[model samples]
Each structure stands twice: as structure tokens, then as C-alpha cells.
Target: MTQPSEGPAATGVPTCYRHPDRETWIRCQRCDKPICPDCMRDAAVGFQCPDCVREASKGSRQNRALYGGERSADPRLTSYVLIGINALVWLAIAATGGTKSRLADLLALRANGLCSPGDGYLYDIERRVCESTGSTFLPAVDDGAWWQLVTSVFTHVEIWHVAMNMFALFIFGPALEGIIGRARFLAVYLVSGLASSVLVLFLSSQYGSTVGASGALFGLLGALLVAARKARLNSQWLMQNLAIGVVITVVGWRMISWQGHLGGFLGGVVAAALIAYAPKEHRPLVQWGGLALVTLVLLGLTALRVSTLA
Candidate 1:
């Protein structure tokens, strides 16, 4: 053989740095190191070695929203999922019996039991008396119907009711999700719904039943308002809409569950404030911690209410 040249390529094919036994003609675009097919990772211009790829990833900053939330790839995804769930539930209720659906009875939030005296209407009555009258008895939160607190948020008896709430969700949900990210947006919705239920347990008549996504939608509205304020955008339109909602709630108090609306609004405000104003140095900690505290407070209030009802 001829005398060995100064360069390895002059004598033989270059070997991969990672796998010395494997020969390769390709060099890493980033580090210019010989790389075999197994060691190659595609990059903007050409293939890179694993080491170079890892180093580049480390140096790259992750994309985040203004409120310290991860930027969403599809902001409408979460809202669409929520809407789909509500729609499915609504269809189930309709297929069962609309207003008189047993599904509704099982899902609607009621603080105390009610008696249905074979008239398709419920009345507050003692279990003993209801049984004596041969009427059907329905249990409530006080009687271990705790699931109703969440189920009711997805329940609706009227087409118009579901339509209006879903329309509102479609309008506001994606916007807020884009700003705060999907996970935070979902948390705001659920916590707000729970808060609304708790307030309903305390404020509504024990005999009355409540249902609908109004609470969660109101929560989104509240969150959107806070986000707008934080972004220094004009919120006059939001304020006007809120005022209109307040008027509607006041006027329709006899028919609507104002307790749910107010509770959800308040919950959303607190949750959004915590998320939007969290310290940049410890954003996730402060945001999640504040939400947890709010949840605990709501639970404590629920426990207190349960004690009274029990």
C-alpha cells in the first residue's frame, strides 16, 4: 500500500464519530463530524449528528404566550372538545325525554331532595311524607348526589338554552385559549363551574334544580376581560356585554340561576388574575398555587354548606 496520508479520508472512508466501526461519506452539517445514517438527524439545511442536534435544542428558547403559557398549536381545539362534550350530553338528554328526562333529574344540581307526586313536577317534601304519598323521590347533594355539581354544568333542558351557551362559548373560548393556553383555559372553566355549583348550593332554594353551561361560559367571559386588561386593549365592549348580562340575570332571576352566573364570574376573575399577574420568575408556581388556594376555599365553603344541608 502507498504511504498513509495525513488525512484519514486519504487512506480510507471516514468513520462515524459515534460509531467508529461504521464508515460514512456524509458529515454533520452543524459540527462537520462524520456521521452514519443511524446517527443522522434532519435539520434545516442538512443532516446533523445527535450531539449537535441536542446542543441546538438546548440553546433554543421555548415559545410562550404573554401570560407565561405555552403557545398553542391549535387554539380552537380545547373549545371544540368542550363543545362536543356538551353537544353529546345534550343529545343524550333529548333522546331520553327533554325536560322530563330522568337523565336530567340525575344530572341537575339540587341541594336537597324533591318529591314528584306523579304530576311531572317536583316539590320539596320530607322523604317520609313523599314515600307515604307513593310519590317518586329524588335525591340531592345533601343525599350524596355530589356528582350533580359537575354534571349539571353540562346539562340543559331546552334547545335555546344549549344553543345560547354554546354560541357564547364558541365566541369567547378560542380567544381566551390563545391567550392563556389550553390547559389554563380548561382549568378556568372547570374551577368556575365548580364555584358556580357551590354558590348554587348555598344561595338557591333547596327545592329548586339548576342546570346549564352558563356558569362556565360566564367564567370564560370573565377570563377574557382580564386578559384584555392585561394586554392593554380597550375593554369597553366587554364591559358593555357584561352589563347586558347583569341586566339579563337580574331581569330573569326567577327563571335563571343568577347564583351560578355570579359565582362563575367571580371564579373566573380570581383565576384569571392569578394567571395573568403571576411573577415572571415563578409564574407557574404562583398561578397554580393561587388557583389551588381558590379551589380549597371553595371546597371549604362547600363543606360548610354540606354541613348545614346534612
Candidate 2:
């Protein structure tokens, strides 16, 4: 095996070679060598000098820190915030009657006096393709209303739907976000939501106005799985959580859209892996590439939806 490329400059030490009377060493707590940080072995708490290597015993509290100054993980707080946002949106939908024209009438989109308003995130399959009734809520396929993807996440038909979605989001999202920091976590959440929607719109057989944060919630789970792996974590706990998701998904298939869940899960996984694990230099490329891929997929799904209608 090739040795590290340490030049002669590293062989000599500014550290006192032989401290007779004037010099002493704090020594690295680990290796015990009198090394400055430049030569210090990696440790969780403080530098480890070379001589202490054989004697050092370590505890694990060092590696798993998530927030400020060695604070405990805060996935719980993250979950509650997500639940609150989704719950607010769910209440908005509930205020309106869960009907095609009613939602359209409320959201303010009308076509040929056929547009219904209120807050249904999607037009059902029959409405999406067989009819051209307008929607105040569902953005036009070609319009620049990118907010649709984001807002769509908040639109759920019933209390239990949003509640379940928010519950899962509360569990997984905070954990994942805590690992990646607020900004990265936000990216994972939003992009995964869009990815999930695009995937459903592309492959789903049913098309009734659909909306929920479940896609983002699934994305958080995916990100948590990937991040755990990268962090060299023992993922048994997270794996069990994922199993719960799988069970809930299969059992609830008639009520929740599996296509959206799957799409969102996959999107979250890809986005998290790409963002969380990429080298610093490559992060920008990964982010832009994700945006481009999701945008293209969204466009393609729209085309397919329109074609089916025609």
C-alpha cells in the first residue's frame, strides 16, 4: 500500500524535541504524542497525541450531535413544525366543499364558466382528461405557476389524510433535516415534494384533485435512510421506521396514492444522496442537475396528462 505523501517538512517538528527544563506537553488525549493540531489525530472531543493511542478509550456521545453545541437530536421539533404547516392547509381545504366546481370557484380559476373553485389540489382523472372544466386551484399545465407544486403539498381532502401525512413528516423529516442543516433539509423537503408529484402525474391511473405533504414526508424518510448510511450510522432504528412506512403504505393504498408516495420517496432518496453526500465542489452541480431533472419530469408528466385528455 502506498504511504501518505508526507514531505521532509513534516518529519521535523516545531514541537520541542526534547523538553528538558523549559517545555512540557499537554499531549494528545488519544495518541499521546505532543502534537499540535496540525499533526493531531482526529478525535471527537480534543486532539489526540501519538503516544496515547494504545491507552485511549472513547465514548460515542461525540459523533451524533445535531444542533448547537452538542445538543440532542431534535427530530421531534421538526416533525411538529411540518405537521402544523400541513394541518393549516388541510383546514383550508375543509372550509370548502370537496367538489370539482366548488374548489375551482374558490381558488379563482374559471374557463367557459365551467371553472370550479375552492381548494382541491388536482382535478380527478375524469376531470383531468375527459372534461375541460376549469380549476381555480389546479394551475394550468403550461403556466408559470410553479407555486402549484409547493402549494399542492398543503392541499389534502380530509383530516386523517393530512394528519397521517403530517404524522409521518413529523417523525422522519426533523431527523433528516437535523442531519443536513436547515437549508439542505428544506431543499430535500421541497424538491422531493415536486419529484413525488411529477412521478404520480406521469404514471398514476387516477387523477382526481390530489394534494398532500405525504410526498415530502416520504422524501424525508428517504433522506434519513441515505444520510444514516453515509454517516456510518447503525440504521436498525431507521430501518424499522421505514418498515412501518411500507406497511402503512400498502394497507392504505385504496385511500392514499401509492404512486405519489413512491415517487416522493424515490425523489427524496435521490435528492438527499446527491446533495448530502456530494463533495463540496460538486454540490452546486448536483443541486442544479436535480432542479433540471425534476423540471423536465414535471413538463413530461404534463404532456402525458394533456395527451390522455385529448
Give each model's whole-structure lDDT.
0.87, 0.60
lDDT of 1 by residue, 50-139 (tens): 998887765354556668767788989998998898898999999998987888889999989989887867788878899898987887
Where does candidate 1 have its weakest 10-residue lDDT segment? 1-10
Q: Candidate 2 on 1-310: residue-level lDDT in tens?
A: 2234343333333442223122234466644546544445566777665445334433233533332112235545655766776676556656665533344233321111122333533433333442444444334332333455566776766666767777677667667766766656767788788777666656654324356787777888888888888878888987887788789889988867677788788888887777656665666676657656865776677556655544
Question: Which sections of candidate 1 miss by over 4 Å?
Answer: 1-62, 126-134
Candidate 1's C-alpha lDDT?
A: 0.87
List, in order, the clash count of every candidate structure. Answer: 0, 31
Error of 2 at 16 (Å): 28
lDDT of 1 at 125: 83
